[model samples]
Target: MREEGKSIDEAINIAGETRFLPVVLTSITAICGLIPIAMNPNPQIAPLAIVLIGGLISSTILSRIVTPVMYKLIPPQMDEKI
Candidate 1:
């Protein structure tokens, strides 16, 4: 979006909106895929699966909320010409 000359806020908004579906779908798919492993009676695999599920959930939530807010708060770096 910025490459197309959109302002920072517009770019951020557009990017966030554009990425929302894919991110959510991927996360949901991964979580669902991991469900059987997470429920496994194999202790080692089950714990790993549980951790991965939690990580996926936390990262998905944080990226959706924190990323946009941080982008808004931080100023974009400008290229310095000699």
Candidate 2:
């Protein structure tokens, strides 16, 4: 994107759109995993499910808020071009 002369913000927006489907799929998978654990209580297996669900939920929310801002704040280093 930098090579194409796109700004970081534009790149971030485009990248997010491109990556949206994979995110949705994973979110659904996480929720599906959560359901089985919720239905039958297993002390050991449940914690991992809870942690994954919590992380997935919070990170999805936070990243949607943070990623673009972070991209804007930290401009790409010229030496970091792929």
Candidate 3:
């Protein structure tokens, strides 16, 4: 689609929508994985949870930053009659 000169919206719509699910899922998984560490009575999983949580937050922010840039970089489709 990028090679075909399709616009960001067009390519995105074609590919599904929003394209944020994977990012959202990853963030959720990270937070979930940290639960055991965060709530651990033994304190062994605390570091793991912290790292996962941090990564999830970073990824979410990065996604927000990158999505718009990607959309801008990709040109929209020109043939509306098709």
On lDDT, the leading prediction is: 1
CA-lDDT, candidates in order: 0.91, 0.79, 0.71
| Candidate 3: tens digits of C-alpha lDDT, residues 1-82 | 7567776667666554456777788788778877877777766677767777887888788777676667678645556555
lDDT of 1 by residue, 1-82 (tens): 6656789989888889999999999999999999999999998899999999999999999999999989889867766658
Task: Kindly give the stretch of ten consecutive residues in candidate 2 with the minimal lDDT sum.
Answer: 73-82
Clash count, candidate 3: 4
Shift in Å, residue 63, candidate 1: 0.6
lDDT of 3: 0.71
lDDT computed for candidate 1? 0.91
Q: Give candidate 2 misplaced runs (Cα > 4 Å).
A: 80-82
Candidate 2 lDDT over residue span 1-82, tens digit each = 8768887778888988887778878887888878778556778887887788888888877777787788788877866546
- Which candidate has the highest TM-score of all? 1
Candidate 3's TM-score = 0.56
Sum up the clashes in candidate 2. Answer: 0
Where is model 1 poorest over a 10-residue stretch in terms of lDDT?
A: 73-82
Worst 10 residues of 3 by lDDT: 73-82
Structure candidate 3, residue pairs in collision: 7-75, 7-76, 7-77, 37-45
